[model samples]
Target: MSNEMIKCTNVSFKYIKDSEGDKKEKYAVKDVNLEVKNGEFLVILGHNGSGKSTMAKHMNALVIPTEGTVVVDGLDTKEPKNVWDIRSKAGMVFQNPDNQLVATIVEEDVAFGPENLGVEPSQIRVRVDESLEKVGMSKYKRHAPHLLSGGQKQRVAIAGILAIQPECIIFDEPTAMLDPIGRKEVLKTIKELNKKHGITIILITHYMDEAAQADRIIVMDGGSVKMEGTPKEIFPRVEHMKKIGLDVPQVTELAYELKKAGIDINEKILNVDEMVNELCQLK
Candidate 1:
């Protein structure tokens, strides 16, 4: 089996103008190359219009590249025959939970994906139950989706994808519309999926704290990759991140300022506990 799950080679996408007078071509993603290993947790950070979402769409064959190729699990996305296989391996969860939910009932919503895949009815039942349990929503199997909270609804949405048995999942700002508690729930579920189930996670978010949990971070700007590194390496370049219209975790920024003030604290402090421990060491 190959360790590489996804490979984007010199990918680029440009939107064509519909009107004759509009001669402008806007490239959403430009000559980008990226590789994702199996079971890796990768986060993408960028402001609005940074091409992060555009790149994500390519992972599942939702948006074919205009200039290059996207291969998922060794299946080229551009090939019509490979489309279903690529999508089965790479499921996408978008920002709005409401939009993703198709059925009124939770269990039905979770089963929708598998049912569409032509799974056996018995297998679909098992998968629906298992997927809901994985997201901690098994108890709500009979509950109405609209009655659930935002976090719960999102979990149901995730379960829907889980039922499809995808190897990799792309979350495009899944927590953007959530509250802090909701965000925490979704993030916890995502981490658990990656750690326990060995699912590859491609999380795209504006939240610095969320990106902090990723094994690697890729920063995008103006339809191009601006920076790529581990959280420790990427967050410490606070000035550059700020210049690119992104923020680091609060603790990292504080550590950076303290370093600027000649303190012996580490500039790569990612969380409060690390900051406290570094301060205690200095004292």
Candidate 2:
């Protein structure tokens, strides 16, 4: 098997505009090339309209590039026959859990994906159980999805995708609609999915703290990638990030300010724990 789970070569996408007898095309994603290794965790950061989400859609074959190619798990997305296989391998979780939830009952919703995939009935039962357990939602299997909290609902949604047994999962701002606690819950689950389960993750989020957890970060601007590096490498450029209408993690911003004040603190600190340790070293 190839080490790469996804590859986009010189990909570009344009949205068609039709109004008042005018037909024009506006590019949402420019010529971009990227590769995601198996079991890699990649976070994409961008301001609104930067095309991060559009680029993500290509991974799952949801949006085919107007020019260039997107290959997922060795299957070319532009091929009609490969579409189903590509989608099965690369499942997507959108921003809104409510929109993704289909069944009324939690377990039923979790089962929906496998059922559609034509998994054997007996195997579907096992998968539904395992998926819920993976997401820490097994205890609520019998509950109605409507009754669960926002975080719980989102976990159930994740369980649904997990039931599909995808090799890669693209999370398009999964925590945007969530509360602080809910965001924490979802982020933890995401990390475990990638680290423990060996699943490839492509997360598109605006939260700098969330990006800090990824193995690599890609910053998008004007429909193209502006910066790409590890969290330690990317978050240190506080001025550049802010100039692009994006912010570093709160701790990183604090570290940046301290460095400007002539303090001998590490400017690349990402989390509060790191900041505390850096401050203690000043003595």
Candidate 3:
């Protein structure tokens, strides 16, 4: 069996021109080809208007490609018959948690997905419990979603998708609205989902720190993938990243500067601990 969970082949998307005088078509994404392995944690980094979110939306058929194909779990997203199946297998979590939650109560919100799929009520109950537990939101099952913190509400939103038993989840700036604490919580939860639950994670973010935690990183620029590699490999190309209007992790940037100044520190330093250890060795 193929290990690939999501595949985009020469995909491109163009929004229709508005009836009010705009004539030229604008492509949000352009001939982007990518593949996501099952259970892998993949991070996508790009500046605003780089089409990262637009690329993510194609994973679950939320936006069909204007050219080529998006195949999720071997189902082509462009096929009308495959739309629901593809969506069920590849769930999406957007920027705002508030926009995703539909029920007043947390568990009910989680149950909504499975219920729509015609899952039995008893099965829905099991799924709701399991999904909430996976996201560490089990204790808030009966709590009103509005009363929860941003992170907690996002967990509820994730649980709602988990209830549908998706093989992969596309997170489009899931932590963009979050505080540092909330960001940590959501990031940890998603990592656990990818590591323990064996779910593929495709995270779109502007956070360099978050990208550093991924198994692989894809850097997008001008609606196409400009670079793709492991964090250690990607972060070291500091100048190249900057040229595309993106930054590396803070420590990595510091290490890069030090390297330029004739210091023997590694340019691949991704975190404070690594930087500290490298500097200590230099001493």
- List the candidates' TM-scores in order: 0.98, 0.98, 0.98
Give me candidate 3's TM-score against the actual structure.
0.98
Compare the candidates by lDDT and give the number of the best one. 1
> lDDT per residue, candidate 2, 26-51, as tens digits?
99999998999999999999999999
Clash pairs, candidate 1, are: none
Candidate 1 residue-wise lDDT, 44-112, digit = tens: 999999999999999999999999999999999989999999888999999999999999899999999
Error of 3 at 263 (Å): 0.8
lDDT of each: 0.95, 0.94, 0.94
Off by over 4 Å in 1: 17-20
Better of 1 and 2 by lDDT: 1
